[model samples]
Target: MNRLDFLKHLGLLSAGAAILPTNFSSIKQSPFTELRGGIGMFSMQGGTIGWYTTDGAIVVIDSQFPDPAHAFVEGISAFGTGPQKVLFNSHHHGDHTGGNLVFENDGYTIIAQKNVPALQRTAAQNSDNEANQAYAATTFENEFSFDAGDETINAKYYGPAHTKGDSVIWFENANIAHMGDLVFNRLYPFIDRNGGAMISGWINLLETVAAKANSETLFIFGHGKPEFGVTGSREDLLHKRDFLSHLLEYTQKGIDAGRSREEITSRTSFDEFPEHISPSNFLSLPRNLDVAWLELTNS
Candidate 1:
């Protein structure tokens, strides 16, 4: 059999289904999308949760918050009788890892980047909620891989792009990739500089991820505007990269003109980029600018 036939036999390389927020809201449940190769995504409140089931075993890529995670667990359980479960955190963010305990308490081994626990623990302590966390039981420095039958699920760190512990989860056979908070679709994203997010590094990371995906690959995003929604193609990833690049350029120009931090921060949004600046969360632009300014001036 040829490669295309082999992939077809595996139920991969097909056109994808785009998920809309309204679809989830109307159902009154966290949205569940079935992809090729037994892979799917569940969007609740935080980062999108990616899951793969093969041979009665399920491997989860990120768990949203606790409340949504609970609902997600229940919703997905109906898909199959997959007694085995494992979880992975795309980053240390609460929205991504908050629901880990749901799975952890259910006997799943929670995994993450090596830097996750420290950030997770620190965020919990800072909020005085250390007892509420579902920290990762396993951590890796570079990459981690798990093979369930012929479907290969792999995760790799691209450095402090979205956060210090950020990584991308890939469902190899299905050609589906979960970007967590890395690609925020067309909405303005939270650049967690407090958690080691660097704008320049984030730009590079998007390029790296975009290159790995072909025209057929379906990408799931962490968050999107109410109208924009998540789950898109590689072009969406490049859209974010271009936005960040323009943001850096715009900020650098302001700095070169000797604008104070406050002056730069005072600007609500970049003139040319509507993709990264949301009117409702207009304040986020200044915050990202503040960080971009600091990174450019300091480095």
Candidate 2:
């Protein structure tokens, strides 16, 4: 099966469903594969996780879920005796932060953008699953950076893209960036418009990120089509940017032509993005166009 189908089979396509308690015992442990300079990535379920192992500490980018998080902690112990562990949440999505409780209970320092806590709480409360979440103890407004042994880790917020609290975590020395859910790779992204996701801002943020990294820089994406994989370079970011741009342009044209909302959102594919097809009907072009219509009409 394709990677998107694999994700659907894992029951990860439904945002609300993912918040329900999962059968931890059924999950297989996912291993970390080093990318460069002690930095690596772990992928089992939910969003992809990025990790950094220093001489004295281990830094984690995003946590998938409690089960995977537990496996990650156990697996990383083989790295070194680094008692200082740091967790950075890329956003408030449950897929990324559901495992924060695992890290928090283990005495890890959890950090995230300032707006994450409120958004996280609201989401949990809405689902009546607040008991399962762990909020970040430390919060930053625009940018935050600190040293983890020889590596410098930077987290920065560039307005609202995927969500109001999305941040890009950069491991400076390793030249690796954990883009979180800001990038969906070749899949149709979950555009949380109600959660303050602005596609225009998202496109601009992608441009800023591409300009910040060089040709050699490596990026870990939250999700990817099996064919594309989860790790990529600057061009991948541009590809996503192009898709969002076209989405808006197409929706705008339909709106100007006095087409009905149903007609506009009924499209199944875009000639420019043939590879963007999603196996999950929830994330298909109709849903994306629905959100685009909402944004364009300011509804």
Candidate 3:
């Protein structure tokens, strides 16, 4: 079947019925302290984060892992009237975009980078599953902007990092920015090679984000706690850049020394960077290392 028919068939499934909850009790249990203009963070998938703006409108950065999307929406209900307006999918990964169908069925307009729809289309065709197909329509590319109450969320695609279509949402009026999966806070980054993610390009984009912000800007990372005010500075971006640079360097050294992938994985070059190499961050290192190795060799 073609893409359009496939999407239609996929949409026929119970979209609302497919939502599953990702544990977000930690963030919910904490004080509902307003970040700026009543923006707050809701935890999902242990560390996966989403944000809620004032005006009772919600824009979930990444919809947590599958099943958690339902729980996230349900969790947010306590904070406001209900989830209305849009949901932003930072990238096309299941961890981020899996909840698209659930939100879409609930009358939420799903927004994403332009390339996200194409990626979801491919995933839907391959899975031939109801959930995946239902998610195909909620993707966009480049940049999109929306005005919520007094806030203006300007979402722009900044090359590739975690995924080819990764985008960051800048709340211009509120002086806050959501880096989607692009900024994992203080964790090892997940670079989706299959989606054309580039480590160097990712670093470059972070630099660009750092350059755009001032001390008053609040940064809502895809993961980790929200950094209010000048908490997220150029230093934070530098820290990530250093981590990626080190990973590329060490992985290249191993490859140059004729080390096998297994050998490299068994070693501890990455262990030194405890700041970015946490349990959550470590999961993506090997894959990230491999991708970096390929890019360095090809260059």
> What are the per-model numbers of colliding residue pairs?
0, 0, 9
lDDT of each: 0.76, 0.87, 0.63
**lDDT preference between candidates 2 and 3, better one:** 2
Q: Give per-residue CA lDDT, model 3, range 1-299, as digits (tens).
A: 76544432232221112232332233234423357665666543422455665666876666654466676666666666444657777777665666677777666777778788777667666667545434534555567887777777788988877778988787787677777667666555566676788888888888888889887877766553222211365567667777888877888889889988777655434666665433333345765677787777774
Model 3: per-residue Cα lDDT at residue 199: 86
TM-score of each: 0.87, 0.92, 0.76
Taking all chains together, the TM-score of candidate 3 against the true structure is 0.76
Q: Tens-digit lDDT track for model 2 on 1-299?
A: 86545544455463334443344455454457888888899876678889988787989988888898898888888765468889999999888998999999887899999999999999989989899999999999999999987799999999999999999999999899999988888888889987899999999999999999999999999977767888999999999999999999999999999999999999989988988857477677899999999999999
Candidate 2 at 50: error in angstroms?
A: 0.5
lDDT of model number 1 = 0.76
lDDT of 1 by residue, 196-228 (tens): 998999999999999999999998887765455
Worst 10 residues of 2 by lDDT: 14-23
Which of the numbered candidates is closest to the native, going by highest TM-score? 2
List candidate 3 stretches off by more than 4 Å. 1-33, 46-49, 54-57, 65-67, 75-84, 124-133, 136-140, 225-234, 252-266, 278-284
**lDDT top scorer:** 2
Summed over model 2, clashes come to: 0
By descending lDDT, how would the candidates be arranged? Answer: 2, 1, 3
